[model samples]
Target: MNLAVFPRRGYVKDPTPIESCPAFSKALGGKVNIFIKRDDLLPGCAGGNKTRKLDFCMADALAKGADTIITCGAVQSNHCRLTLSWAVKEGLDCHLVLEERVKGSYKPEASGNNFLFKLMGVKSITVVPGGSNMMGEMEALAARLKEAGRTPYIIPGGASNPIGATGYVSCAQETLQQLFDMGLKVDHMVVPSGSAGTHAGIVVGMVGNNANIPVSGINVSRTKADQEALVRKLARETAQRVGMSGEFPDEAVTCFDGYVGPGYSLPTESMVEAVRLLAQTEGILLDPVYSGKAMAGLVDLVRSGYFAEGSNVLFLHTGGSPALYAYLDTFK
Candidate 1:
């Protein structure tokens, strides 16, 4: 498929890299080689995976002559931080609807992304109770902007739509090139599955590029069946956007929900261990909610002999390390 036909919106650079995670490897007893695709290092606002989606989403916004950007996410959303970052960079106003998916988690005095949101110059923020209709909230925000005579563009959470997912498809292509250059072969790749864009886009990109490596999602929320369905739906839509033919096999989109403990953003014992291990071993910080849980799953899967001994596994470090601060007590 010719993805070039889609507007890149000024993010036309090659992807970061698939680098060896020596620290994380040693923590796992070196049972399997661990490498990371550092999407977390992608440029923008202390960096995170959402930058990839914003590359395309911002392009669409600019194309539509939007002067303001509106989006929604959980209170400590990395996506929200990055959205505001990009909006600042593009000279557009940014507004956010903070969802308290976990009741009482939305404190006006909270740290982490909330602090960053203010520092990043978000024009406004509206806090909604958990389970509020996000689309309705966004529409309301847009309507308010219209009343003020501003041209506003709405980007869905995590930019999970096809346009946002193209970031991951592009990321997959970049990963393949990096692997080739490094003379490495990745047998499997694991990533956090939340909004589903990263998982879906990577699936589409790998399939389009004929890279047969399986992409496994460690669910940060939702179940295996539900997450898989959401990912497949997004992947197919992304594939169609890029003009790729054929369907993504149902079995290809896989997720493991065994790791989501208690609920989203709630710390688990495994999550704490995973976070500390990565930080101490590799000096790489992972947020408690997403990447920490994902690493926990990856470690367990490796220990269970899911991958052959010495198999090279790539983990996409989607980045939310800042949120770690909010959960300081958990680790302490």
Candidate 2:
């Protein structure tokens, strides 16, 4: 709530749209109403949830006089793509450590964000196994850059730290304002949870604003328990960053892991159907890895009557549609 105390580079000058999804809602065949927060349209090379976090993270990098930015993520990481994209905009060299989350998942000639990594002028991209020590690797990269007389900043995967999470805190403010203006009350908010920043930031934001709306995360990587713990920790840290009580209020966070399907970035039957349904019904596309699966979960929940009758549910469309190029075979 006290955003004035912190510094921001200002990536979001305009609030992303909150639109009704009548076709998708009717597809559910329930009394429930559905809406979407189109964060996928946020500014960046391909636009995504990471754009919000970068507003703060990039500002910190600039204040530190960082000449190069180093960060890590999975092979097709939307966060990595957006980070490099913003780095280029700020005239900073960007380097990446891409984790092959699934062994042999890293293909130098791969499309999607991997292609963007090269196109965006990334100074370097190091591929490591899923279990590689990310912070240590980034530190070693920083040391090497220092020896070369370049100042470097290390951004954690997904910018999950307290500072980066503030972007979603601001997002919460924006969403609530929009809902009030539109005379709508959202009973539940759904998001794709991976690396925790977006989910945690929304939880922290909701608590800080006393929005009284529950934030549900469809876990894209970790299990429900693991993801919940991670999100709670980040939410608390984000709250502390803004001079809040730094404690996640009771029932502030919830996550569902059933939609992960085979594994990280692996496609599932449900995800494919959800993607197709949304594309056909709303002319909207959701990336395979994150939002697609989250949509699948939302779809399943609606069909299963998870929400009370006549409830209003909002899905946060954290974008990664550009990566759809890499998974061309999945759709066909």
CA RMSD of each candidate after superposition: 1.1, 1.0
Model 1 segments more than 4 A misplaced: none
Off by over 4 Å in 2: none
Q: How high is the CA lDDT of each candidate model?
A: 0.90, 0.92
Which residue pairs clash within candidate 2?
none
lDDT of 1 by residue, 199-219 (tens): 999988898888999889999
- In the range 1-332, model 2's lDDT, one tens digit per residue, is 78867888888889999989999999889578999999999999989999999999999999998989999999998999999999999999999998888998899999999999998888999998888999998999999999999999999999999999999998989999999999999999999999999998988888888888988899998898899999988887788887776466746789999999889999999999999999999999899999999999999999999999899999999999988899999999
Task: Give Cα distance to truth, residue 305, candidate 2, Å.
Answer: 0.4
